[model samples]
Target: MTAINFAVIGYGGMGSYHIHNIMPNENERIHVVGTYDISGERQKISSQHKHKIYHSLEEVLTDETIEAVLIATPNDSHKDLAIQALKVGKHVVCEKPVTMNVEELDEVLKVAKETGQTFMVHQNRRWDPDFLITRELYKKQQIGELFQIESRVQGANGIPGDWRHELKHGGGMLLDWGVHLLDQLLFLVDSRIEKVSADLSYILGDEVDNGFITYIIFENGIRAIIEVGTTNYTKLPRWYLKGTQGTAVIQDWDLSGEMIVDSGKKNIQAPKPIQAGVGLTKTMAPPSEEATETVALPKITAEYDTFYKNFYKVVREQAEPVVKNEEVRQVMVLIEEIFKAAKR
Candidate 1:
């Protein structure tokens, strides 16, 4: 199989990461031909790394040899860059949030359809090990029927970079981290959202939120809470899944956590009342040792690095994209709804 050649449109943090870390080798299915960045400093850096540096977007677009381009620019620039790449007969791999809003994304999607080029969003969080384990438990019922899921990421650092602090640039935890969390939830649930509510944090006083919490109710009776925090010094579990028969917690990116399930032992010992703050309460007591059994978190076999591999397949062999445009749009639509709900 031939490798699909790609160019980096914006050689910033994420763009640089892609060119260096993601583009594996000559043997891989994807190759980085060069980069296009308005910043001369970034262009110099790209050249230092032995990549062909294009001076302008036009220069990159007109290069008939480059089959695809990755848009790692600011969130607001995603729509125009994606549309231009598609119109020029190049497939596109865009960063998360895809665009500032659903309307902007819709316009890009229209161009992609007209040009018949693959347009896939980099919703890479779907491949996260923590999420993969939870998804496996959801599908296999390793514990039981999972009914509640809490997914979150927290940091003591405020907004990480300059543009991320400004609303015009699509800065904020909602558009930044929120997009990934929501995408993972949507991908895992596989059900229509029956209801939505949200609260965005502005404690840092930026025009955009520093954090946010969104509660989503699914048609299949599953409840999901997605949250992102910039002020949290101590953090909650990265993922918490509750099933009728067991519970699992993925504490951090390291995938630390545990699972406890129904013991299913006949005539298990009953729980005894425990001391409360001021009084004794049986309802708040812990489950008796005989009632539940602790187990290791389920192991998953999916790899997270397959994003570019799938992109190559979609662009070269007309394979269906793992990250579909419609799914990307749906996440954007849900983001819009979250904004409206927060306004209320």
Candidate 2:
């Protein structure tokens, strides 16, 4: 199969990541022919990296060799840039928080339909190993029917970089990290969200949220608590889940965690209660060791390359995208709801 030529717009962190790390390992299904960024400094960096740098976006758009454009620009510019690329008959691979809101995404989706171009967002966390392992457990019910899911990502760094601190660029933890965690939850649950409530933190005194916590109730009776923090020096488990039989926790990005399931063999003595500051209680005691078995996390094969591979398939073979526009739109809807709930 001929490699699909792709031009990366916005030669910043994520753009360079795709160019240096992702594209080099794509098995030749896609090629980055050139790149364009509004900042001359970024263009200079791209050139120094041996990539052809387009002086203007128009030049990249007019290039017949470029079949697609990857938009790693700010969230606010996604809709306009995506629409323009699609209009020029180029397939689009956009970064997360597809647009500022559902309405904006709808406009781009409409143009995609009219132009007969394939569009996909880079909700790449869907490929994260920790998430994949968790998803596997959810599907296999390894811990029994999951009733609660707790997902979080916390960093003590506060919000880094310049543009992310500005409201005009769709800057905030919600639009930034919130989308990834929320999207992963929505993907894992596979049920309609019945209700939602959220609180956005402004601890850093920015116009946008520095962090947020959202509670979601799924139609299937599953409850999800998704949170993102930029000020947490002491972080919580990356993934925690509760189910009928037992529980599972993925402690961090290292995929270090345990799944403890009821052994169901019986005849085990109860956990001995320990004296507390005020009193002793058996209710808060840990389960007897014989009553439950701690198991290692399910092994998950890495599939990061599938995102671009799926995009190529969609562009050339008319296959459905891995990260569909409809799914991304649902995440946008949820983001809006989170904002409203936070305000309240």
Candidate 3:
């Protein structure tokens, strides 16, 4: 296997995470040569991990041995770093929320085309096990023709860092967590989005939103609610999907959940109507026990190529990328539409 030498341009939380998760276990075909970060502290930290520290971005770009660059910096810097790397004839793997806006991503795509470099975004959630399970459920109709999907992630920690609280850095809950949720939806649903409505929350009173709720309607008769909140004292289930014949819920990252579907068994007896506060009703009565069944969500059978593996294959002209530039561009466009809808 020919190893592709890779350089990381940021040493922040996600940058370090990429090293821990992707770099070490990569097949002999990939390696993390070193890293470049303007932060001296981050440089010191990288040294502790046995990774060399580059003096500057230019130095890393000029090195012929390095074949790819990973941009894990703030949202605003993704486009510039990506373009610069591509111009130097290096493939790039940019973090999610590829750029602050679709136009910026357009500029990066132009550079990638001009240089013939393989450019892909790290929309890693596309490979998450929980999401994979949910996608399988939707695609296979395990719950029976899903029509409504609600996805959310909540935290009480508020905004995590300095750059995330400012608008200029492209800081907002929508751009941060929003990108992941929206990307997942776009990947799972094949229909075009017919409408989008959103409301951004400012409970923390920062210049940027702390969280948001986005409602998307797809042409295939699917309605999705993607939400992220920092002010919630209690979190909702990670996933709640409704279908014509049954419903499913995934409570958390642990994939703890179940599906309940009608069993099509006739009731042996009629339900005894219970009185409400002022009236008796049978319409809201629970289904007979024999009429439904609860089952574990079927395990999903899918595998994802690591980000670097795909990068190498694409650069070698051996295969197409899992994260194509056009799909990423559409995600950015949807994000813009979401922002517009929230502001209206």
Best candidate, lDDT: 2
lDDT at 311, model 3 = 73
Candidate 1: lDDT of 2? Answer: 81
Displacement of residue 313 (Cα, Å) in model 3 is 1.9
**Candidate 2, pairs of clashing residues:** none
Model 1: lDDT of residue 71: 96
Tell me how candidate 1 scores on lDDT: 0.90
> Which tens-of-lDDT digit does each residue in 12-85 have in candidate 3?
99899888777644476668889999999999999999998999999999999999989999999998999999
Off by over 4 Å in 2: 24-26
RMSD of 3: 1.8
The weakest ten consecutive residues by lDDT in model 2 span 19-28
- Residue 168 of model 3 has an lDDT of 91
Instruction: Go through the candidates in order and give each one's C-alpha lDDT.
Output: 0.90, 0.92, 0.89
Query: Runs in model 3 with CA error above 4 Å?
Result: 24-26, 267-272, 275-281, 301-305
List model 1 lDDT by residue over 144-203, tens digit each: 999999999999999998999999999999999999998888888889999999999999
Lowest-lDDT window of 10 residues in candidate 3? 300-309
